[model samples]
Target: MSQPPPPPPNQPPQGGGFGAPQDPPPGGFGPPTPPAGPPAGPPQQPQPGYGYPQAPPQAPQTPPPAAPAGPPQQPYGYPQGPGAPQGAPQQPPAQPGYGYPGQQPAQPGYGYPGQQPPYGYPQPSTMPMQPQAPQGRRKLNAQAAIIVAAVVAIALIVGGGVMYAKSSDKGDDKDTSAGSGGTEGKNDNEGGEDVGGGGGTEKVPSSTSAKVLFQVPAAEVPKKDVWSVAGSWLTDKVYAKSGVSEVVGYDPDSGKESWTLPLSGLTCAGSPEITKDGVAVVVAEDAKRTKANPYPDCTEVTAFDLDTGKELWTKSVAPGGGEKTAFKEVSITGTTVAAGSGLNGGAAFDISNGKILWQPKVGSCEDVGYAGGEQLVAVRKCGDYGNEKYEVQQLDPKSGTVKWSYKLPDGIDNAKVISTKPVVFGVDSGEITASGATDVFSLDDSGKLRAKITLEDGKYEHDCGVNAVHNCKAIAVGNDKLYVPTKQHEGAKQYSRVNEIVSFSLATGKPTSDRADAGEGYEIFPIRMDGSNVIAYKNGPYDKGSQVVSIDGKSFKETKLLETPATDQVRSAISGMVPKSSEMRYTGGRLFMAEDLISAPYSADEKDYAAIGFGAK
Candidate 1:
């Protein structure tokens, strides 16, 4: 009988095994803190490793120093990354490659006998040595572990799971609406104050200190930002990508014009996120690149004044970063600014002056994230694909040493740090792009599991888009309430179903009060917690009728936020799902929502998109 052959190098399994690593839970957050990081760029299956034919060891000389006087010379017999520059004697798949450090080297093959091929590549010779790893005392065996990780990264890059995960660093842990429940005390509304309902097209007020508006033309704005970050609020202005490789800030109060920082040729890796005082952007120093260089030829990252376009400092990836692939996610908190990419693990820099702080020693193809706050970065290290264990570590943003780590509980999807303060951890049971369940744990920064918010059926499911948590993982910690989503199919029309937002009290881990149901056909998602309210809405491209609904923490009153719709491009981007520019956002006590649904700019003559801003009336 004929049998099937092995998969291509660095390829996912032939079966249905790949899944989104960081899909969020209901309301985007839920019971029990599950480790959360940045969004897993594109879900990929960990590839299978192969082996090389073994060769007899000649003799072991005192292994060379970590940093050889020059690049360590590859012995005439040893194979290296990319297989000895092609056409070299190919190692056969006779024995398993080596694994685990401090172990004897296999009989000079690709790996220990039976070891999977490194990163699923045809038994490449040796794993590329990490430039930053210690040289003097480290043993040759140490490279074995790193070699395995590098192989996994290669698998990730080829598999298309680019970005990994990151956590939001909103401060403080006070819970105002602590206790309340539902019919069984699951939806208690004890915290609802005396605020009356603002429904029926009543105009919602805008703050004098801030406002929201879209930049002209859809082609100009950045494609997206970090999770939940349509735009950033720093100082008195809200900043976002407006033009091609340009960032613009507007006053949050009156929607007045502010400063615009333009990068002629460089591309914004992703939308900029705020640091303590400045906004950080990861862009290429040179727009043009080639195989010798790479896309984002230079991952030159810069920090700029939130109020002015002045440059604060600049930093680039370390030397020897093979591709120096452009960074995709950047974060700034306290005095540290860190960027992550498959090219560089996690590079943390000093915000005061662009100085390299530290970096992780991983392949130039795996995703890493600044997953926690209080100066913490998160990274996920996976073994072979057949094995379902993922090792997650929290590292000091300043020093790349592991402060702590744990094996993600088995039988769950990938896990990453989602929130640093109040340290909420999240785990996915399915892919975010489709339907799945997210289990959240409330753990301290030290990795202690404090609480778990279990749902009615222990999962959040529906017709999820790319990220299941799109509207399911909303955490209202300030109000001591956690919000989750569920769809009730009461009518025949697909739009006739109502998406329910169930609020739970942090004090009891149960529903706090009455669940708020979006009008039929509308799927209301909580964008963020606005002080005493949860800002919820259904943004749809070309669905001119979506509304922003604010549910008060104390009164549980539903206030329909009011705003002006600007342009079709902005409308298309702010449709809530697959936002092209992250146009509609909420920050600094204000909620920004596009009032109209339209198409992307298809014609030469198109109106710039518009949105409405609502705040305390």
Candidate 2:
């Protein structure tokens, strides 16, 4: 046998040398290796302690006996193969372009020396970093958006509500009538049809024929100098010229005579006053024809029905022994009617009947007595001749019992008491000084003075030369405001044009400083306070010429000026020359004025008076 030809290169060695461990050349038994570096690969036997099995020397090599069946064993100096077991199936030798143990594979398009994968194999993809929401930011933005929208919505809603409320309020204040002066039955600019004669005494026009809509004439023969006038709403009539005391009803719209109630045996010196329920209470003297000595002895307090001109009741109040006495001033409020005797204090009566309620003795020569809520305030002159001073006394409305008295300061020539709650007094100097003053005093229920307010200190001076405090002609209180009017002096002539009207706050006693110059030749009478409007007469640029002026009580501004033309007149008659006396009065929604002219026919000596009515336009 030829020595077996030195076993073929790849075959195992013969028998007994199998265990001979002369270290094989680095690559284990094989043909002499070329200089191309030891077989390009990891070492066949792992380093000691690497946990790899030792390889047999001269052992048959069949692809290096595939690495143990399970995961390949870990090599020394390198971490165990990821997910590989201590002993496992060995992976095939890395393909071209693949990496050796512990080495990364070459990128698909790149080559490491000769290592490279076959073309067309896909490379592992790198996943993009997953996007993440900013921490807490999304939730925070959602909340902020909601809050912004809510704020905007609330602002819009509030603004819209305010606008709507303002519009509704404006609509409520608008007046819907044609114009301030539009007449009910006439075209906008056209005047009413003339109904009666232009001048001379023709027949008295009937209500249907009268151009004037509302008028009240003297029910009884008119007095020579009428000082005061009063009206009753229940009866729709007026009591005029006290002493003659005529009660008349005229159409509120046409001024034509409606009815007349005559008081034959009565005379009044003061303005007739009406009760809240519409009864007329007047201080009157017995008719001249009925009693010869009617001055003091026959004086009586009379209550009359406004509707029928019927006397409701009468009560005679005379000093001891039925002595001749005169009751000067009479006033009526809600529940009581009171009269002040010129020299005696006052007496009150039940408004429901004519029964006497109370009679309290006051000082001598009382100027005026006023009836308020449940109290009576009287102004009287005290002391003896020439040195007399005035005093104000408070009395119980129901019992006529004296509550208290206040002695007025000296030098007070004349004084008037206006109201009770916030008592006001208008006192004039006894001297020739043009200065006058108004003093406000607060009083308790028992009549003690609580506070004193002096309204003005100097002479009354205005553009028209009338001093308000000194020459105050009229003072009235309404809606808690005091209205004082002073004569406007134009040189020697006292005219309404120069008249000044001033308002004062009753509670504070401070002048409102609201002054209105009513223009030249117009007199202002504080007629009525309706809501915020004050109704006053703008009388006499001339006798028959008058206008109605409505003032804003709050702003003291003139709002409405209404002109009413008098009926035409004929020439030369005494009546034609004697201008009509126009009077103005106001109620809830209406203003009424009476135009009366005493006429004497030109050719006849006879005298007659014609009355007409003028309604507020």
Top candidate by lDDT: 1
> Counting only residues 3 or more apart in sequence or on different chains, how many pairs clash (N, Cα, C under 3 Å) in candidate 1?
92
Query: Backbone clashes in each candidate structure, one number apiece?
Result: 92, 28
* lDDT tens readout by residue for model 1, 57-113: 233355522433643332212334442234422222233111101112223222332
- Please give the TM-score that candidate 2 achieves against the real structure: 0.50
**1-617, model 2: which lDDT tens digit per residue?**
54321111111111211111222222221211223332234312211111111111232334333234653333221222353234322232234111111222112111112222122101111111111123232211211122232223222210000000000000001111100100001111222222122111111111111122322222222222111222233113432222234555443443334455555334442222344444666655444432343222325677765545566777765444443344545665456787765433456778778887756443334433553432456665656434556567776667755577766544443445544444545543222223343344444455444333333322132110011111122344554666655444442243223456666554433345566666765555554343345545554443344555556666666644344443222111112212212223333223343222121121121222222233333
> Which window of 10 residues has the lowest lDDT sum in candidate 2?
158-167
lDDT of each: 0.38, 0.37
For model 2, how big is the CA root-mean-square deviation? 54.9
In Å, residue 614's CA in model 2 sits off its true spot by: 2.1
TM-score of model 1 relative to the true fold? 0.54
